[model samples]
Target: MSRHDLQPKADQPHVVRATVGWDRPLQTFFAQVFFRTEDEPDEGEALIWLGTEPGEMLTPEAVIAVVAPHVEMPPDLAERLNAEMRQTTGMKDGRHQAAAKRSLFGSIH
Candidate 1:
């Protein structure tokens, strides 16, 4: 069976995790995100693990809502990031493979 075939049902929740290194840039970013949350008292240093169930259709806004506060990215940069992610994720769909292939080469299959 294909990987997608083994994946959980459309209604099921899929977990996506990102581990960001704690350096000068990341530290400043995290401070902004944690600044508002009162639940997290000790924000000096931590390995944050954000969890969400984004069903079948994954939206850019959903992702940004979680990450935007942490990092300061320009509108153009954010758009580029979202576009790149959409394209990368498109590879998983067999229907888009031909288009993806064409992206690598100048001509369509």
Candidate 2:
């Protein structure tokens, strides 16, 4: 991950999550901030917002704006999420896509 990535603390499970990418089940390229729980991890999450529409790229302000009404959002959370979106989608800066890739693609050579 890049230094600019908005990653949640990995040490513990969090109720809120922010992600930027194509969702397999949702089948779209999006940036999202939502809440979920351990009991029903699959579909329990309450979406604050889906930051980008299909065929649209992410905008950091949108992701940050989505979280604002939900709680007293931390400054770092907003900043990190913005940075991650910028890094991943390259809407601002150019695409540094290596960090954003979900997994290795193709087959063994």
Q: Mind giving the per-residue lDDT tens digits that candidate 2 earns over 1-109?
A: 2222233444424435555443322223355554566765754464544623333434445544544444344566646545544444433212333333323322111
Best by TM-score: 2
Candidate 1 global CA lDDT score: 0.32
Using lDDT as the measure, which candidate wins? 2
lDDT of 1 by residue, 1-109 (tens): 0000011223322212222211111111111123323454343222333321113214435434554445543455436444544444423325464475467544333
lDDT of 1 at 17: 21
Go through the candidates in order and give the clash count of each: 0, 0
Model 1 misplaced stretches (Cα beyond 4 Å): 1-47, 50-57, 89-109
TM-score per prediction, in order, is 0.30, 0.34
Instruction: At residue 53, give the lDDT of candidate 2.
Output: 35
* Clash count (model 2, backbone only): 0
